[model samples]
Target: MRYPENWVNTKPGLDQVVKKLSSLTSLEFKLTDALIGDALILFEHKFRNIGDILINAFTIVTKRDILSICLRELLNPERTFNHYDLFEFVINVIDKPEEKILFQLEEYAIENPMMDVFQDNNGLIPQACTILKYPSIMYEYMLVKFGTKSRVTRYLMKEIITAHIGKAKLIKFYPSLASSVLMDFRWQELDYIFNTYCMAGVPFEPEFLPLVKTCPSDTVIKCLFDGYLSRLFGFKVEFTLSRVDQLPIFNIIPFTHREHNASSEANKEKVEWLNAINCNQYEPITDTFRRHLEKFRSRLRLNLI
Candidate 1:
């Protein structure tokens, strides 16, 4: 026999079941066990009605065994229902006037912040971002329950941003999150962050430059040069393979040289040496070195005041 296509949307029927389940104060354990068995049977039939009934009843009247059974069933990957429906049911419970149910949902989101409720190829990241999309959902349920700027929220944000960037196509969907992730100080992820920032056309901040300066990766440097500083700031910096014959030989100099001529050609050679090897090569040099370099000839400009 074919099951009813709208079996999952039978809220009225579920509400009746919830009422029956709630009235079992004397025989609560027996009723709950029976409900659990019925819920499992309904779930196997792909009818979420019994599950909804059990969840609503458990939320109103707390029973550890029943709640655990419902949660285990909710999290089961083999369940026929999709995450959107499950999320809707949870949200409905959260929105109810009853504080106990809302509190339970809040506690659940905190404990299982990265729950595998969704079937997206991206896993929990999308569901996390969806929760974040509704800041009211975050502010009302998550923030109060988990506290502001909690580790769970931060972790979810990190995962979402990483997963979003991993799929090049999805980056455009979350431009603001992408930009925020780029501002992180962790040196290793800088290039990915920098490239995402450039791709999103997000405004550059002066704070970012100092962070990028700390990274030693050549790829990070090249990204800074080609992706951001060169085009965005309109600088003419380019990386090219220097010929073996053109490479300069190193010459040692005394630590202290007397009669240092700040305006002499000898000073230009010293500036060149510093620019060639100094970590701050990106910084502009004085007149003589500036004259020979096409890019630095035009004094470097700061995009942010």
Candidate 2:
């Protein structure tokens, strides 16, 4: 980005942008440094006596564009500062070794229908609440609802609620908190997906009718509980990458709710995610996540065998 001859009077804000990037790998650090350095060399030739401090500021369109490209290339590491990087750390489950046991019940054994995935005693929330640098909404929710030392098993069930009710609709039931703390973080992308899609008036499969019918204030659950008729009956899948957005390719199905229809009204949607997968905003897939995902899949296969 070139500064006009008069901009020498303006402060150099670009350096702050570069300084903020904490490259995890040597390659990333070198690339980031090299790019900034090269940009400065060109800046010197292009602008006289601007001083060596370069940082990104929203003041100029060109500089903004350059900063955009530069930070994006850095994978735009989380500015967690003293906060936990949820996306980076959330998937840590892949690193954990899976424990398994094969057991057969006796003919007269009583049925214990509880599924383990539904249990939160060993879930991400408990561990996250303790270590996260900043107290987040989820952490706060955990503390108030489950307490610091222990966790409740039904945490994800609330996910279905938030996904359906959204922060906006929560104003009716939850009111103050909905208008406050519950406002920002996505409980599920339901708020966005419904607002965007409903506003757009997207169509759904006929079988999806049952989901619509069963949808409740805490509803985003109907779609998954559909009878195996959906399995027996062929249906094209609609992919949802997150609550608010869909994957580019065909997705399985998306969840939506009409109310609580709130979230990231920052004019952001799940589709805008660039920092989560890898740090590369340019690539559609995150290389790092793909590696972990493959390992998870391998572990799953071994368990199946």
RMSD of every candidate to native, in Å, equals 21.0, 21.2
Maximum-lDDT candidate: 1
Candidate 1 TM-score over all chains jointly: 0.27
Candidate 1, residue 109: the lDDT equals 48
Question: How well is each residue in 121-157 modelled by candidate 1, as lDDT tens digits?
Answer: 2332342332222212222232223322343333333
TM-score of each: 0.27, 0.22
Worst 10 residues of 1 by lDDT: 246-255
Runs with alpha carbons beyond 4 Å of true place in candidate 2:
5-74, 77-118, 121-190, 193-218, 225-232, 235-305
Whole-model Cα lDDT of every candidate shown, in order: 0.37, 0.29
Tell me the tens digit of each residue's lDDT in model 2 across 1-305: 44456765764466543434432222354334446535533543332233324433321322344433432222222222221222112112212111100011112111212122122122222211112222233233322322211212122222322234232233333444543333344333334433333322222223222222223332232222121111112222222323433323311122121343335421232223212222332433224334433443454357557
Winning model by TM-score? 1
Q: How far off is residue 218 in model 1, in Å?
A: 11
